[model samples]
Target: MEKRFISLIRFRVAKAQYLNMGLKFKKLLISFFSVFIILASFGLGNYFGKSQCKVCPPEEIDFSLFWEAYHNLQEKFVDKEKLDIQKMIYGAISGMVKSLEDPYTVFLKPEESKRFIEDVTGTFEGVGMEIGIRKGQLQVIAPLEGTPAQRVGLRAGDKILEINGTSTVDMIVEEAVNLIRGPKDTEVTLTILREGWEKPKEFKIVRDIVEVPSLKWEVKRPASGYPDIAYIKLYQFSEKASFDFSKAAIEIMESPCKKIILDLRNNPGGYLEVAQDISGWFLERGEIVVIEDFGGKKEQKIYKAQGPSQFLDYPIVILINAGSASGSEILAGALRDNRGILLIGEKSFGKGSVQELEKLKEGSSLKITVARWLTPKGELIADKGLEPDIEVEMTEEDYEAGRDPQLDKAIEVIKNL
Candidate 1:
C-alpha cells in the first residue's frame, strides 16, 4: 500500500515539472518574436524617414529656423482657431515666387487660378483693358476699342493710383485685377494719373462681359479726293483670330482699295500662334516672323510664316502706340522686318516675355516667364520696345478733343506709299 501511494506522488510531481517547462518555452518564443517585431518595425520606419528626407539636402540646408518660426507661430498666435495651414502654405509659395522680382512670374491660389483661366479663355467680366506692372506702378497696357475702358478714355501708359477707391500702393497686379472685375453692369472707379496731368483723374467705368473681337475692317472714306485705302483694326489675337483674319483678308482682297492700313494701336496681345498666323497674311511661307530666345540654354526657336502671303506688295502701313504689345508688337516687327512695311506711332508696350502656365495640385497654377521675344532682326523687345519709323506722339490735347493724329499720320504715310 505504501509503495503504490509513493508512485502516485512521484507521477504528480513529474507532470507539474513538465507543465512548468512547457510554459517557460512558450514565454521564450513570445519574447523572441516580440523583439523581432520591434526591430522590423524600427527598420521600416528608418527606411521611410531616409526616403522622405532625400528630397532636401540636410547638409546644405538647415530648416531649423523655419521650423522654429512655424512652431513659435503655432504656440504664440492669439487667434489659434483662425489659423489656416493651407493658406500659410500658399503664402509661403507666394513669397518664394515674389522673391524672383519678376512681375510676370506669379503664383495663383486656387480661386485666383480659376479667375486666371477665365482671363486666358477670354470669357470673363471686366472692363476691357490689359493691365501690367511697369516701373513699379500699375499701368494700363491697352484698352480694347469700343469697350467700357476705351469708351471712358483709358489710355495706355496711364498710371493707376487707385481701383474702386482702394489705394494700389502695394497691390499686386492680380489683386488689382480682381478688384476691377465684377458682375456685368457693376461699376468700378479708377483714379489714373496721366503723363501731362498735374492731378489724377477719376474715371468711373461700368464692367461688362468683355468680348474681344479679333479684326474689324472698313474702307477708309477720306475727305473729297484722298486715295482709297482699306482700314483694318486688329483688336486682339483671341481664339479663332486666324479664321476671322482670313475672312477679313478675303473682304479686303475683294475691295477696290489695294492699299491697306493695319491699325494695331491699342492691341494688347493674345495667342502667340495667332500672331504668327496673322503675320502669315503679309509674309511668305518660311520667312522668319519672330524669334524665341531661351537664354541660349536651348536652341532659339525661330517662328516662320506657315501660311501664304495675301498682301505681299499691297503697301500696308501699320499704326502703333504705347498700347501695342505682345502679338501686336510681333506683327508690327515682322511686317517691318520681312515686308518693308512702315510703323508710325509711339513706341510699343514692352511686354515681350513669354509665360507658361503650369497647373499644380488642388487646382492651383503657376505662371512663370520661360523666354523672351526677339524680333526677326534680333531686337530684344523686353524693355526696348519697337521704335516706329515715324514717331508720332498723341498728346493730351488730342485725347480731350477726340483727335486721332496717329491714324491721320498713317493715312498720310500710306498715300505717299
Candidate 2:
C-alpha cells in the first residue's frame, strides 16, 4: 500500500512539470510575433514618411550639383584657412536672393537687420534720406524734410554715382545707404547726377539724429481776396501719423479754413496701416483705400476706409513729387480715385510693393516683396507711378531761391475749387 501511494505522488509531479514547459513555449511564440509586427509597422511608416515629406526636393530638380560643388570646395580648394563656413553660407543665400532680381527682397545679416528696424521706428543717426534701386542704378527716393539730406540739397530721382569717393556702380541700395550713413556730426560726401546737370556734383552732408515728423498744419490767409486754405504738410505716414493728423484735423475743423492743401512732397512712406487710418479722414466709410494683389496666386486683400470722414466734403488738393512714395502714393491714389480730388505737382515715386519682413535664425531677416499695390481703380503703383493732374516742374533755381511752384499751384487750384 505504501509503494502504490509513492508512485501516485510521482505521477502528479510529472504532469505539473509538463504543463509548465508548454506555458513557457506559448509565451515565447507570443513575444516573437509582437516584435515581428512592430518591426513591420516601423518599416512601412518609414517608407510612407519619405514619400510624404513636405521639404523633399521635387523629382525634376537634382540637388546633387549643389552637393557636388560643396564637396569639391571642401576637398579640393586650396587656402583652407580663408574658407569660412558661416560666411560661405551667407554668401550663398545672398546670391540666391539676388538672382531673383527683386531689389526690395533681400537677406539681412544680424547688424543690417537691426539698422532696418531703427529706420522704420522713426529715429536713427544718419543723413536722413530714403534710397532705392531704379533701372539697375542707385537713386535717391526722398530726402526727409528738415533733415541734413534736404538741407544739403539731396533731391529725389538723383542718381547716386559715388559715396565718399567709393564708386556705386553695381552697388545695391543697402550698400549705398551703409556708405552714406555715419555717426552723428560726421560728414559723408555723395556724388549725385540730376537730369539737367552737366556733370555729377558732390554734396557733403553731416549726419544727425533724425526725428521724423508726421504732419504740420497752418491756415493760409492769402491776400484777403481768397478764402483761408488749411495747408497740411504730411512728412511721413509714421507710427505717430494718425494721432498727429487727428489733432491737426481737429484744429483745422475749428479754424475758418474752408479748403485744404495736402502737401505730400518729399514724403517717403511709412506703415500701410497709418496710411489707411489717415485716408479715413478724407474718404467715406467702406470706400476702398488700397488693394494688395498677390498675382492671383492668393485672394486679393482690399483695404477700405474706416472713417471719421471729416474732410469728405472739404475741397482738397494733394501735392506730390518724385519724392512722394509708398503710403503717400496710396493715399494720393485713394483720394483722387474716390473724391475726384486733384493731385498737383510732379509724378509720384513708384514704390508701392508690399514687403513682408520674415525673421530668420541667428537674428537675421529676409525682407521679401510679397505683393504689388493697386489703387482702388486698379491702377498699378509699382514701377509705374501716379501722374499728377497739373504737371509742374521744380527747377534747381526754384529750390535754391526757396520758392515752391508746386505749393503755389496747389493753393491756386484749391481756391478755385
Candidate 3:
C-alpha cells in the first residue's frame, strides 16, 4: 500500500513535469489528451505496463462476483423455514473469503462481525475461548486462562457436542463460538466429550469479561528439584508477540535457570514475522527457520538471533497441544527439527499456510492464501501436523481435579534432561 501511494505520487510529478515543459499549441493539445487518459485510468499498480484492476465507474459493479452472489441467494437458495436474509448476506460475504481459500479469513454475521472488530480493537467481553471446527465437530481449541471457559474446566481437546441443547455437530465454528460466549454473569450450558473421557460431561458456566493474558512467566527456584526451570507462556503470535516474547525471554534470563519451558499449548498463530523473530533468538546466526514455496519461486527465510541466547546450553522443553497452529507450529517445528528443544504435548493444529490480506475498496478486505510454509527440515505442517516426541492427552476428570498432566509431564521431562 505504501509503495502504491509513492508510485501514484511519482506518476503525478512526472505528468506535472511534462506540463511545465514549454511546447507548441499542437503538443499542448496532445499533452492535454494524455493527461485526460491518465486521469481516467486510475490504476492501482502496473506490472510490465499491464494495469492492476483497471478502475471503471461504479456502474460496472453489476458485473462484480458479489452481485452474482446476491442474485443467487435471492433466486436459487432453498429452505424457507428459519430462512434469514441476513444469513444469505453473510454467506455471500463468506463466499468472497472462501474463493481465496484463506482459512484465517473468517466470515461473521452482524453480531459476530461486531465482536471480531471489537477483539481487533484490543478489547471485548465474553467467555474468551479460541474455538474451531475439527472433524465436523465444534471443538474447544483453547480457553484463555482466567476466562469463564477455563475457569469452568474447558479443556483444549474437548469436543463441544451440544450448546444449550442445540447439537453443534455440523454447526460452523463461528456459530458455535457465538452460542458458547455471552455477556458477563450469563450462564451457558455446554455438553462436551473430552479426548480421553469415556462419558460425555456437561457444564453450566457463568460468563465474564475475559481479558486475554498474552504473557506468563514463572521462575522455579531450587536447581536440585526442577532444575531452576523458567516457564514462559506465549498465548498467541499477535502484534505484540515479538515484544512480549522478548520481554519474557529477557526476564527468564535474569533468573538463574538451567532449563526453560516455552508453553505454546493453545496458541492459534497470528503474524508470521512474530514466529521468525522469536525463533531467531534460539537459532544461530544463519539458519533457515522456514521456507515458503510459491510454485515458480521459493522464498527462504534465515532468522538470525540479535540478542544472546541465554538458555542455549540449558534444555528447552516446549509444550504444544492440538490448538497450537500456524505461527506457533512453525516455532515448535523449527526447534524440534533443529534438536534445540524437546516438543511435549499432542500434535499441533496444522495450519501452516501463509496468508496475504489485500485491502479492497470500502471497509472490506480480501485475505488470500498465498503459500504453504515448511519447517527447516522441509516438513509440511498443513493438513499433516507436527508430531510430538511425547504425545499426551488431557481428560475432563483431570481438569476438574485441577491438574495439568501435560505441563506436569513437561516439568518431569525437563528434570530428566
Candidate 4:
C-alpha cells in the first residue's frame, strides 16, 4: 500500500462518492462516442449544433453543443502542431474542477501529484512555510520553527505579493506552494506585505529539508517573581505527537512544578487523532474532545477522550495566537471546555475544514474539501476562530526586543490561580 499522509487538515471524500463519479465519467465517455458515431453517419463533419441534437438524450441536451464545439476546435484550429490532445484533455478536466471556486479543492497534474507524494513522506526540500488564503489574499499561516522561512523572519499574517519575482495576485494556495518549494539549498525570493509596513519587503530564503519536531518542553524557573512552571510547546500534531507529548508529560509531572503552560502559538495543526490522544492525558475518559459535523443532516462524528488523566489535578493554561489552528484549536477548545483551562493570547487561525486527496487518471490527483470540524461546545471553527480567555497582543516592539507578553500573561494567570 502507498504511504499517504492523513492529517487533521487533510482527508478524502468517501469511496462511494468516488465510485459514483467514475460511473458518471464512463457515462460521459459513452455519450461522446455516441455523438461522434451519429455525426459521422450524417456526414455532419465539423458542423456546429445550432439547437438540441434529436439523437442525444434529453438529459444531455446541453452537452451535445459542447461536443460540437470540441470537434470544431479539433478540425478548424490553425495551430495543428501546437494542439496536443492530451494537454487539451487535461486542461479541460482542470478547468471543469477549477470552476468550483473552492481553494481547498484542487486538481494536481501528474508532476504536481508526484511532488505531493514526496511531501507526505515527512521530508521535503522547501522554505517550510505553511500558507493559506485569507480574505482573498495569499497569506502566510506560519513559518515552521527552525526552518529557513522562520530564520528569515517570515511572520504569520504576511500577505504574499510575489514569489521569485512572479506576482502572486489571485494565485491559489497550492500554486503558491509549488512555486515556493524547491531543491534544498536553492534560494527563492518572496515579496511580502505585512501590517504596519510601508511597502512590500523581499526576502531571499534558501530551501532545506524540513523535519518538524512534534513537541518541545522545559521547566522555566521562577520568572518575573513567579513560581516555576512546566512549559510545553506543541509544534504540530504529527504522527509521533502522542508519544512525544507523553514523554514531555512524564518529565513535567516529575518536576517540582504544579502549574503547566501549553504553548500552541504558531502551530499550524496536523492530525485530529493526535490531538485527541494528547487531550486524553488531561481529560477524563469519554469526555467529548471535538465534533465532526458532516453537513446536510449527515450523522455527526464525536471524538471522545481515551484518558489516563495523569494531569487532572494540575492547573493548566493554553497559549495560542493567530498561527494556532485546526488540531491546535481542537485541543485548546477541548481542554478549555472540559477541564476549565484558560487560553491566553490572540485569536487563533480558523481552519476547520477537512480535505481528502484522490488519485485521478494519468497520475493526476484531486484534493476536495469534504467536511468541517466543530469544537466540543458546538462552536464553528471554520471562519470564526477561538477567542482567547485572556487576549494579549504581541506587538512589533515585542518581536524586535524579544519580549513575550502572551507567555508572561499566562504565567501571571497560572500563578494567581
Candidate 5:
C-alpha cells in the first residue's frame, strides 16, 4: 500500500514539472514574436522615412520655427475646440504667399476656390462689380452693366474704403470679394471714395445671381454719313467670351458694317486664350499679339495671332479706361502694336501679370503670378498702363446727363478712318 501511494505522488510531481516546462516554452515563443514585430516595424518606419525625404527638394529652408509656432498654437490656444488644423495649414500657406507682396498671387481655400471658378464661369451671387488692388487701395475695376452695383452708381476707378464697415486697408482682392458676395437677396454695403468726393459715401447694394454678358454689338450709323460701325462692347473674357465673340464676328461679317469700334471700357479681363482668340479676327496670321516675359528665369512665350484675319484691313479703333485690365489690356496692346489701331479713352488699369491656378490637395488652389505681360513691342504693362493715342475723360456730369461723349468721340474717330 505504501509503495502504491509513493508512485502516485511521484507521477503527480512529474505532471507538475511537465506543465511548468510547457508554460516556459510558450513564454519563449511569445517573447520571440514580440521582438520580431518591433524590429519589423522599426525597419518599415526607417524605409518610409528615407523614401519621403528623397521626394522632397534639398532642405534649404529652416522649418523648425514654423513647427514651434504650430505646436505652441495647438497646445496653448484659448479655444481648443476652435483649433482647425486644416485652416491653420491654409493660413500658413496664405501667409507664405502674402510675403511676396503680390496681390495677384494668392492662396484660396476650398470654398474660395469654388468661388473663383464661379467668377470665371460668368455667373455668381454677388453685387456685380469687379474689384482689384491698385496703388495698395481696393479700387472698382468695373461695374457690370445692369447689375446692382452699376445701377447703384458704382463707377470704375472708385476706391472702396470699406465693405460692411470693415476697413479695406490692406485687404486682399479675394478677401474683399468674399465680404462682398453672399446668397441672393442679401444686401452688402460699400463705403466708396470717388476722386472728387470730399467724404466717403456708403452705397447699399443687394446681392443677386449675376449673369455677366461677354460682349454686345450694335450697328451704329454715324450722322456724318460714315460707313456703318460694328460697335462691339466686350464686357469680360469669361468662359463664354470666345464663343460669343465668334458669333459677333460672324454677324458683323454678314452685315454691311465696314468699320469696327471695339469698346473695351470697364472690361476687367478674363482668360488669356480668349484674348488671343479675339485678336485673331483683327490681326494677320502669325502676328505677335502679346509676350509673356518670365523675368529671365525661363524662355519667354510669345502669343501670335491665329488669323481668320477678317478685320485685318478694316478701320478699327479700340476704347479703353481705368477699368480695362488683364485680358482687355492684352487685346488693346495687341491691336495697337500689330495694326496701329487707335486707342481712345482713359489709360488702362494696368493689371498685366499672368496668373496660373495650381490645384492642390483637398480642392484648394494656389494662384501664383507666373509672369508679367509684355506688349508685342516689348513694353511692360505692369504698373505702367497703356497710353491712349487720344485721351478722353468722362465727367460725373456727363454720366448724370446721360451723355456718352466717349462713344461720340469713338464714333468721330472711326468716321475719319
Candidate 6:
C-alpha cells in the first residue's frame, strides 16, 4: 500500500465519506458490523409482488450481463495477465458498490476487509493518523498519539498533498487508508501542507504495529487549581463506550466537584446505540436523545437515565470542536436541547448521517449512508455542522500564550449557571 495511490484517488473523488478498515479493527468491526447486520438481516421481510406467502421458486434474476463481462474480460484483457476468477467476482461486487458514487458506500474486498477488521479493534501497521475530507480536501484529522505520523509532526488540520508522487484531492478516507496502511517496516512518504508552514513538508514515516487504547483518562485535579471542576475526554464511540462513559460519569459523581466538562473534542461518533445509551445517563427517563428522518417515516427514540445521572444536577458544560462528530454531536445535541447545557467551542463536525452497512457474500460489504440524523429540535447536521451556543475559535496567539479561550468561556458560562 503506497501512499502515492491514495493521493491519486483523493484528488479524483473531490470529496469523500470518512471511516476505516483495520484489525484493532475486529472489535470495532464486530461492533459496527453487528449493528449493520442487525439493521439489514434482521428486517421483517420484503418482496416485490403482493403479501403472497408461499414457498416459491429458488428466485432467479438476470445475470447475463455479468457472464458476458466476465468472459469478455478474461479473454480480451489486453495485457494477457493471469486473472483470478474469485478476485474478479470480488471486483464486480466492489464495482457494484462504487457504482453508487457514494464514497461511504464502499465495498471492501476480502484481504483489505480482513485487515480493516484487525486495524480498528486494537492496532496494526500503518503511518499512524486519521484522514478525512474537510471542505473537499484530504486532511489529517489527528495523528495517532506517539505514532509515526504524530512523532513526525503530523498535526490536525494538515492537508495531505501527496503520498509519494500521487495527488490526493478527492479521495475517500477508506480507499486512502487502504492505500496508506501496510505491513510493519514499510516506508511511506507523505507530502504535507500545514497551516503555518510556508512549504509542504515531506516526511518518511515507517509503518508499525499500532495499538490504539480505546480509553484513557486523566484527573483534572483540585490539586491543579480547579478543585470543583472535572474534565473527561472520550476519544471514539465503540462497542464498550456505554460502559466506558458510565465509569467516567461515576467518577465525576464521586468526586467533590460541582462542575464537570465532558471533552468531546476529536471524538468521531461510533455505535449509535452506545451514544443513545450514554446520552441516557445525562437526562431523566422519556427524554428524546435523538431523532431520525429517512423520508419514509420519522423514527425517534427516547432514552431514560438509569445509571449515575446524578451529575446532571451539577453545573455541567460540554466541550466540542471541529473533531466532535456523529455520536458526539448526538450527545451534545441531546444535552443542549433537553437540559439546556451550554456547548462551548467552535462548530461541531456535523456528521449527522446514519449509515447502514450491508454484508455481501464472499467477505465483502457495502456501507451506505441511509439517513440523516436530526437534533431534538429537528436540526439537521449533515453537510452543515452544529453551531455552539458560544462560538469561540482557537487562535494561534492564544496557543502561544498558553491560554484556552474556549475553556475560559465554558467556565464563565458554568459559573453564571
For candidate 6, write residues 169-271 as lDDT tens digits: 6566776887788889898888889777789988788998875444555544333444567666777777887778678777767777667777777676777
Comparing 5 with 6 on TM-score, the higher-scoring candidate is 5
Task: Name the candidate that leads on lDDT.
Answer: 5
True-vs-predicted CA distance for residue 71, candidate 4, Å: 4.2
- Deviating ranges (above 4 Å) for candidate 6: 1-101, 120-122, 144-147, 184-186, 195-199, 213-227, 297-307, 397-403
- Candidate 5's TM-score reads 0.82
Clashes of 4: 3
TM-score of each: 0.84, 0.85, 0.69, 0.82, 0.82, 0.71
Against the reference, the lDDT scores of all candidates come to 0.89, 0.90, 0.74, 0.86, 0.91, 0.73
At residue 345, candidate 1 shows an lDDT of 91
Off by over 4 Å in 2: 1-60, 74-79
Better of 1 and 2 by TM-score: 2
Worst 10 residues of 3 by lDDT: 44-53
For model 4, the superposed segments whose C-alpha errors exceed 4 Å read 1-61, 68-72, 75-82, 223-226
Provide backbone clash counts, one per model.
Answer: 0, 0, 0, 3, 0, 30
- How far in Å is the alpha carbon of 347 misplaced in model 6? 1.8
How far out, in Å, is residue 242 in model 1? 1.4
Least lDDT summed over 10 consecutive residues: which range in candidate 6?
A: 14-23
lDDT of 3 by residue, 297-387 (tens): 6655444344344455668889998888878888888777776578888888777776564654444444455678888888888867888
After superposition, candidate 5 runs with Cα above 4 Å error: 1-50, 53-58, 67-87
The C-alpha RMSD in Å for every predicted model, in order, reads 8.7, 8.5, 15.8, 20.0, 10.2, 23.9
Give the CA lDDT, 0 to 100, for residue 268 in model 5: 88
Arranged by lDDT, best first: 5, 2, 1, 4, 3, 6
Residue 50 in candidate 4 has what lDDT? 28
Lowest lDDT sum, 10 consecutive residues, model 2, at: 115-124
